[model samples]
Each structure stands twice: as C-alpha cells, then as structure tokens.
Target: MKTEKEKMLAGEAYLATDPQLTADRRQAKKACQLINQGDYDDEAGRNAQLAALINFQGSFYVEPPLYVDYGYNILVGDNFYANHGLTILDGARVVMGKNVFIAPNVVISTAGHPLDKVRRAAGEEFVKPITLGDDVWLGAHVTLCPGVTIGNNVVVGAGSVVVHDLPDNSVCVGTPARPVKSLA
Candidate 1:
C-alpha cells in the first residue's frame, strides 16, 4: 500500500504541470465560472455544479464566488457552510465533517511550498491533508495550514493561524493556534 506521503505526491504530480503530465485545470475553471455567474438559485443546481467542480461527499453549501484552487480534491460534509471570500487551496485533500461552519475570509491551504529557495525553484512542493471534524466553527480570517486536524465541536477564533493539530471540543485562537479553552 502506498503511504499517505506517496499518495499525496502522486496527487500533486497529477495537479502540477510538467512535461510528462497533463494538468487538470478544467474542474477549477468550471467551478469558478459557475460561481462567478451568480445565477444559481435552486439547491439541486447549485449542489450539482459544486459536486462536479469538487470531490464532494455528502451534502454541503458554499456561498457564491468562493475561490477553491484544485477543487477536485476537496471533500465537504453534510450541512457545511462557508461564507464569502473563502479560499481553499486544496492541492491535497481537504476533508470537513458534518455541520461545519466557516466564517468569511477563511483560508485553508493544503499545499505548502518549500521554504528552501533551491527546492522551491526546482518545482518541489509538500501537500498535507487538512481534516476538520464534525460541528466545527471557524471564525473570520482564520488560516489553517497543512496537516492540521481539528477535532469535533472545535471553535477557532478569528485571525487564528492553525499550524498544528487541535484536540476535541477545544476553542483555539491566536497565531500558531494555542488552545484557549475547552468547549466540552
């Protein structure tokens, strides 16, 4: 069986452009067109378009004009809601649990470019899967980094940068995301 790292690298290779690979940008472009049109009213149409755009499982809703990079890797759960200006750079898989609520200006990124200049220049990138558990609420301007797993019933405050895993039923805030208190 392929390790997660191997799988991630393979997926990234599929997304990234190289002489050997035909990059899949169609899904992302299609999603952007549908969202930018601002004409989706019926629940079925909106959901169908989004599902086509992304690898969505279960039911979820996204407010229009939402920007998602490589939408083919995102998996949204039932009753998920993301407000305006939500950008998900889902070069890797982004899994969100049921009843999750995300405020405006929230950025969740799965692809992490290399810090080293040479490695970055060589077209090397690291992707880590981001997972948000059930009933999680993220406030406005929250930025979630790669490989972060937020536990169930977690609430992340505005302007927080989550760089590490957060335990269940915790309220996390501030840069680097320290646990403020337990919600349980």
Candidate 2:
C-alpha cells in the first residue's frame, strides 16, 4: 500500500488527515511560524527556522509570513525572491527556476479538493506539480493553479490567475492569464 505522502507525490488522491501527513504539515507550519514571528534583526535565527523545511540555493530571499502545505515539496533554483504574504500549497512538487521573482500575496497551489462534494466530504484531495522557468516574475496577488508549466522569461501581471501553460518570452495578464505581448 502506498503511503499518503507517496500518493501525494505521485499525483494520486490522498487524505490530508493521515497521521504521517498531518505530522509533516505540523512541522512545516511550526517552522513557518517561527520564521514569521522571530526577530527581524536576527537573520541567522530566521534562517535556522527554515533550515529543516526550506532548502536554499545560490542566493534567495523570501520575506516573512510565508505559508506552505509541505515545505519539502517546494524547490527553487538560484536567485529566487518572494515578497511578503506568499503561500504555496505544495502537496505536489513546486519547482521555481533561477532568477524568479514573486511579488506580494502570490499563491502557488498544487493541492485541491475534489469537485464532487461527496469526494470532498470524504476528505479526498489531489495534487499536481507546478513549474516556473527561469527569469519569470509573478506580480502581486497572482495565483498559479495546479499543473502549470510557465516557460522562461515570462511575466505575469498583478491579480491574474493562471490556469494553463504559458510559453517563453511572454507577458500574460487578466483573470485567465493570456499572453498580452510577446517578448520574443
């Protein structure tokens, strides 16, 4: 039998309340809380809090008040930067390439409940990986839905919701984010 965590990584339905998964989430949340509430002047202390859950690449900076379902499922390349109020529902893998910039209040979700109320009530949920290529920038209040693979050199405008894949060298905007201009 596959463990809940395994199922989650495999893009299968799983119960979030499973003992092991619950424990993992709790640990991640604790780390997040400590990082958020810790002294702003104590940079080393804050880094220590995220040492276990978040892995740092070459150079990266994420402002406080970050939230994640499972921090282990998120991986970022070099030079990744995120502003305050960032949330990642990383039930599945979330990979951000190098030189990625995310503005405030951005949401990257890989976990979602079933559309069927019965399944939802049963506590069944699914996850899909989200990928952001290098040189991408997500504006404030942008939301990236599950299973999206955004290409490199792409810019997403504020308050946009991305539901599909975006090609490289493009500027996307609006609710269902469409390419408004090509940077190619």
Candidate 3:
C-alpha cells in the first residue's frame, strides 16, 4: 500500500514539474494580475481570463486576485463565483460544483503535513481531495480542511472551520463545522 507521505510527494512533484501545471500556473498568475488590477469586467473577457486557472468544465465565474498553489489540481463547474482573496492550496484534487459562491478570504486546502514529530520535522506530506457540491455558499473566512466534502446547496457561515462532511442542503457553522439545520 502507498503511504500517505509517498502519495503526497508524488502528487506534489507532479504538480510542481508537469508541463500542464506550469502552463496553468502561468495562467493563474496572469489572471491574478488582471483581476487585482481591475481589468476584464466584461463577461466574455472575464471568462476568457479565468479559463486558464482551473479545469472549468461548465460555466463559472470568479472575482479578482484569485490565488492558488498548484492550480492544475482544481476543477470547477458552472456558475461558480468566488470573491476576493480566494485561495486554494490544491496539493490534491479540489472539485467545486455548479452555482457555488465563496466569499472573501475563503480557503480550500487539500494539503497537510505529518502529525508525527519526526515526519513533521522532515516535512512529510499528506493530501486529500476536497469537494464542494452544487449551489454551495461559503461565507467569509471559511476554511475547508483536507478531504472534506460540502454537499449541494449547503451554506457555511463566516469564520467556520470545516473539518468534516456536510450533507446536502445543510447549514453548517462553528469551528468543527457541525450541521445546525437542514434545508432539504
């Protein structure tokens, strides 16, 4: 069986050196510059610019200054919009579904270091895939942990630290991200 550390390293290496990754990084940088500078207000222009940052299969939208480490590991769906300072550390795959809205300072991270002292000190890596389903809304400063999945139409409150799976149409808040109510 492949160790978590080994898997993480392999994934990171692939992202850091792959040709597609390099190109995607460049594209992300350029798009960030444009977004931060307040260029590309038109729908067509914005779409064209954002096309390079992620594997966007369906229609989606993003606000400016979007930052990501290893952009190639992210995929997005239709009508997705993320506000300013949206950062993703996609050491593994991160999938966002249709009609997703993310407020400012939101972070979707798929990377983690080891918990053990020796492994942590040596920078042993671990990663897990993150998934956000359709129509999900993440409030400002929300942090999504590795391997967590937010199901369709769920709403995560501001400053929430999501560390577990949130079921579809649920309202989740607080540090550990427990469901407070159901919308379904």
Candidate 4:
C-alpha cells in the first residue's frame, strides 16, 4: 500500500485531500507566503525560507508572488531566475536545469484530473513531471503542461501553452507550442 505522497510521485491517481499531502501543501504555502511578504532588501530571509522548501543548486533569484503545491517536488539548478506570478503545481517533480529563466505569470503544472467525470468528481488526479533543460527561457504568461520537456537553449514565446517536448535551440510559440524559429 502506497501513501498519497508516494502515489502522487509515482504518477498514479491519488486523492489530494490526504492528511499528509494536506500538511505538505500547507507548509509549501507558508514558505511561499514568507518569501512573498519578505522585505525586498532582506534577500537572506527570503532565500532562507526558499532554501527550506526547494532543492536549488548554486545561485537562484525568484521574484515575489510565487506559488507551489509541494516545494519539495521542485528542483532548480544554478542561475535560475523567475519573475513575478510564477505558479508551479508540482504534484510531481519539476526540474529546471542551469541558467533557466522564467518571465511573469507563468504556470507550470504537473497535476491534472482525469477526463472521466466520475473520476474527476471523486477528486482522482495524476501527475507527470515537467523538465526544463539548461539555458531555457519561458516568456510571460506561458503555461507548461504535464510531461513536457523543454530542450536546452530553447526560448518559448509569450502567451504560449506548451503541451509537448520542444527541441533544443528553437523558438516556440502558439497554443500547442510548436517551434517557429531554429537557432541551431
């Protein structure tokens, strides 16, 4: 028998209302609140709170108004920078490689409910991890869906919704997010 956390991490359908999962979400929310409300000059306080929540490597800078479901599921590499209004529904792992940059109002969601009405009504949901390779940049209002892998040196345009894997060194845009320009 697997716990809700284990099921969620394994990409299996799980109930979000489980006690331990609820507690984890609460902790993440508290950390986000502390980081968001911290004084701009008090980088140490903000970083301290963020450090306690996420697994970040080397250096990172995240602007206020950031949100996450479970901070422990996120892993950010060196020189990661995210602007305001970044929301990560990290039901599973959200891995960002080195030099990743995210603009304002970006939503990276790893959790989704089943298409079946009964399952959705029962609060059954599954998660798929999202990964961003090194030197990736996501523009403002971009939405990265579950199971997406943005390749290295890729630049996603503003207001785009990425639903699939994007090749390296490309510029992508649109609803389903297809590469429009190849930098290679």
Candidate 5:
C-alpha cells in the first residue's frame, strides 16, 4: 500500500490531512516564513533558507514573500528569477529550466482537489507536475495551473491563466492562454 505522501507524489488521490503530509507542509511553511522575514539585502541568508527548502541548481534569485506547500517537490535550473508574491503548491514536481523569469504575484500550482463534493469534503486531493522550459518569461500575475508544460523561449503575458500546454517560442496571452503569436 502506498503511503499518502507517495500517492500524492504519484498524482493519485490522497488525503491532505495525513500526518506525514501535514508535517512536511509545516516544515515548508516555517522555511518560507524565515525566508520572508529575512532582510531583503541578506541574499546569503535568503538563499540558504531556499536551499534548505527546494532542489535548486546553479544560481537563482527569488524576492521575498514566497509560499510553497511542499518545497522539496520543486526544482529550478540555472539563473531562475522571480519577483515578489510567488506561490507554488508543489504536491507534485515543479521543474523549471534555465533562465526562467517570473514577474510579481505569479502562482505555479500542482495541487488540485477533487471535483466531487464528497471527496472534497473528505479533503482528498491530487496533483500534477508543472514544467517550464528554458528562457521562459511569465509576466505579472500569471497563473500556471496543474500539469502545465510551457515550452522554451515562450512569453506569457501579464495576468494570463495558462490551462494547457504551450508550444515552444510562442507568445501567449489572455484567460485560458491562447497562443497569440509564434516567435519561431
């Protein structure tokens, strides 16, 4: 039998209130709090906290006030940068490639609750991985939904809600995030 954490990571429906999951979330919350409370100019302190929280590669910069459910489920490649108010509900893996830039108030979420009222009331949830390819840029207030895979060199306009996979070198905008133009 799979544990709740195992099921959650595998994208299977699991109870969010399971003790192990709750403990992991608590740890992540504490790390986030420390990072947020640390001085903005104290890059070393902030990066140290983030290193303890996630699997980061090379160098990255994230402005304070970041939130995550399970920080261990997230991985970022070289030269990633995000402005303030970034939130990631990383129940499943969130992988970002090199040179990803995110504007303020962006949300990248992998956690999703069941649509059935009974399941929702029971606190059952599932998750899907989110991927961002190299050189991707997300404008301010962009929301990347579960299972979204944005391709290389793509530019998502401000306030866009990406609900589907985006092709490489595309410029996407608006709600539901249709490809407005191809950059190829």
Candidate 6:
C-alpha cells in the first residue's frame, strides 16, 4: 500500500488530514515563521531557514511572509528572486530553473481538490507538479495552477491565472493566461 505522502506525490487521491502530511506542513510553517521573524539584514539566517524548509539550490532571495506545504517538494535553481507574499502548495513537486523572478503575492499550487463535492468534503486531494524554466518572470498576484509548465524567457502579466502550459519566449496575460506575443 502506498503511504499518504507517496500517494500525494504520485498525483493520486489522498487524505490531507493524514498525520505525516500534517506534521510536514507544521514543520514548514514553523520554518516560515522563523524566517518571517528574522531581520531583513540577516541574509544568512533567512537563507538557512529557507534551506531547511525546502529543496532550495544555488543562489536565491525570497522576501518573506512566504508560505508552503511540504516544502521538501519544492526545488528552485540559481538566481531566483521572489518578492513578498509568496505561497507554494507543493504537495507534488515544484521545479524552477535559473533566473526565475517572482513578484509579490504570487502563488504556485500543486494540490487540487476533487471536483466531486462529496470527495472534496471528505478531504481527498490530488497533486500535480509545476515547472518553470530559466529566465521566467511572474508579475505580481500571478497564480500558477497545478500542472502548469512555463517555458524559458516567458513573462506572465500581473493578476494572470496560468491554467495551461505556456510556450517558450512568450508573453502571457489575463485570466486563463493566453500567449499575447512571442519573443522569438
């Protein structure tokens, strides 16, 4: 039998209230709290906390008030910068390549509840991985939904909701984000 975490990672329906999942989320929350309380000048401390919280790699700057669920499922590459209020519901994996810039109030969620009200009410949820390639920029308030794969050098406009895979070197905007132009 698959563990709850295993099921979650596999994109299979799982119980969110499972003890292990709850503990993981609590640990992530504690790390976020510590980071949020630390001084802005204490870069090392903040980075350490973030490192303990997630699968962070290379160099990165994350302005706090950040939140995550199962931080271990997130992987960010070099030269990443995220402004305030960044939230990642990484029930499944979230991978980001080098030079990714995220503006304030941006959310990347990998967990999705079932459409069936009965199942949703029962706390059953599934996860899908989200990926962002190198040199990607997300404007303020942008929300990247589950299973989104944004290509390299792409720019997502502010307040946009990315619901589908975006092509490389494209500029996307508005709800259900559509490619407005190609940079290539």
Backbone collision count in every prediction? 0, 0, 2, 0, 0, 0
What's the TM-score of each model vs. the native? Answer: 0.85, 0.97, 0.81, 0.98, 0.98, 0.98
128-176, model 2: which lDDT tens digit per residue? 9999999999999999999999999999999999999999999999889
- Give one digit per residue, the lDDT tens place, for model 3 in 58-161: 86767777888666788898877788889998878999888899999999988777677886666555678999999999999999998899999999999999
| Candidate 6 residue-wise lDDT at 143 | 97
Model 6 poorest ten-residue lDDT run = 48-57
Every candidate's lDDT: 0.80, 0.91, 0.80, 0.95, 0.95, 0.94
Q: Is candidate 3 or candidate 5 better by lDDT?
A: 5
- Per-residue CA lDDT of candidate 5, range 95-129, in tens? 99999999999999898888899999999998999
Q: Which lDDT tens digits does candidate 4 get at residues 88-168?
A: 999999999999999999999999999999999998889999999999999999999999999999999999999999999
Pitting candidate 5 against candidate 6, the one with the higher lDDT is 5
For model 6, what is the error of residue 90's alpha carbon versus the real structure, in angstroms, after optimal superposition? 0.1
Candidate 1 clashes between residue pairs 3 or more apart in a chain or in different chains: none
Better of 3 and 4 by TM-score: 4
CA RMSD (A), model 4: 0.7
* Model 6 clashing-pair count: 0
Instruction: Let me know the TM-score candidate 1 reaches against the reference structure.
Output: 0.85
Q: For candidate 1, give the lDDT of residue 136.
A: 96
User: Residue 24: error of model 4 in Å?
Assistant: 0.4
lDDT score, candidate 6: 0.94
